[model samples]
Target: MESSTRTGFAKRRRSLQGPFLSEDNIDVQSDVYIWNSLLSGYAKSSMFNEALDVFRRLLNCPICVADSYTYPNVIKACGALGIEFHGRMIHGVVVKSGYVCDVVVASSLVGMYAKFNLFGDSRILALSLQNDVVLCKSLINVYFACKDHCSARLVSENNIDVQSDVYIWNSLLSGYAKSSMFNEALEVFRRLLNCPFCVADSYTYPNVIKACGALGREFHGRVIHSVVVKSEHVCDVVVASSLVGMYAKFNLLGDSVQVFDEMPERDVACWNAVMSCFYQSGEAEKALELFDRRF
Candidate 1:
């Protein structure tokens, strides 16, 4: 009964909000509290579209600005709705509005990515806030915790630590790889090889390997494998899994199997990768056999 009353109140408030402000001689542009309440009501009632509409109204209202109080439940709505394009746009606004550093707003953004696994959207959002190191670090940590190392590889971002050559070079490598500019990716990798300050870590090999695979340059991939082996960075699960896929992409079944077999531990992704490699290579029995071993 009480829940129904709250819903009724929310509905009536939506209808009468403008008139109530006008009648009360309140400046709609200055009364952010009213707008926030409306947003909260719509979001709490699961009226996500309505809440976003209210946000649009708030944005359209002259001289009005959203405060720290405005974003949590609304962002929750975005996550509930899969953090769509609108959410990404709003995040850009949040950064510009300088509310991104607000603990509540930060939490909501983190929750949107962390709870929903919208790493792609989250990564985009994180990259947009190039000026806020704290929020970027927070979001980046979440991506790393989720083992989404690719997202950590950074896009075409320049603001992140120019002092760290590895960070900058990796960003170039990853940005090129992500954009499917395989030649550019390899160029960056090759350049990094000569840079005394930039040593490619486990973080660096996956995208470089992916580019080699994309270009179908198995020889280049093998050369990188040699570098990884010499650098003693071949043991990481991510890099090892990438090697498995890269060798498989080259149709080097023996090489792919050798890489897979050498892993000290196998995650589900690594297991699925090798199975798919086997299945694609017309080794159905072997795929099933591997599945049984996994079980």
Candidate 2:
């Protein structure tokens, strides 16, 4: 029975891995644990719709009643999707099922309400729960989203006792980039660079490079390129792609081509980045030649 449950969970997890999963792939015989595992895995992986699909399946299954473990994953998925109405619906279910007291479920609810800018609701829910780093980070993110930068900074500062990690810095960097605060993004990247213990990885390079691209700062971009080389993450496909894009944006087609050429394993995305560079630089013929070669 335990083995079957794990198999069912794996099957559901694999089904939800793609951009579009076929309905036929779902295992109708999956138990509550399997369904809950699917929901949890999918939500954590940012497969929000897939997580919701698992939740709906659980809701319909007579034998698969969602327990406390199930609510947190579904609630987080709802939050990530920014569907406040459905989030509230899930909240009602949580209250009715008496899972509201579960720390995981409560934290997810706080995050969900904060995601929708319903700070009042989030604060009320949060008050009943013990403060944790995850909840604190959620508030920081929500405040940042609401353009309360000062509050965001204050929250992060107040939580200084909680050691910061590269992930938090990356989050701040990406947030700045999204807000078109490229300079600030670079500043955050600089702060991250100065940290002795924290190391920038494949994920870090792309966002910083993206900020450099947006500013058209070739000097900074070159510096980042050197950093990527030093970090030995230059071969990472995402980093390579971002570097190609950064060079392309700066109208340095030659540099973009050089980066693309050096990539040992070129995916369709990397190929497209180089082709796009050529196309955007008024080299349609070259772009076509590359596309033909790719095919």
Give per-residue CA lDDT, model 2, range 245-269, as digits (tens). 9999998999999999998888877
Candidate 2 C-alpha error for residue 26, in Å: 31
Cα deviation of 46, candidate 2, in Å: 21
Collision count for each candidate, in order: 0, 0
Compute the lDDT for candidate 1: 0.74
Clashing pairs in 2: none
lDDT of 2 at 43: 64
- Candidate 2 stretches greater than 4 Å from native: 1-152, 158-164
TM-score of 1: 0.54
Residue-pair clashes, model 1: 0
Give the distance in Å from residue 47's predicted Cα in candidate 1 to where it truly belongs: 12
Error of 2 at 180 (Å): 3.1
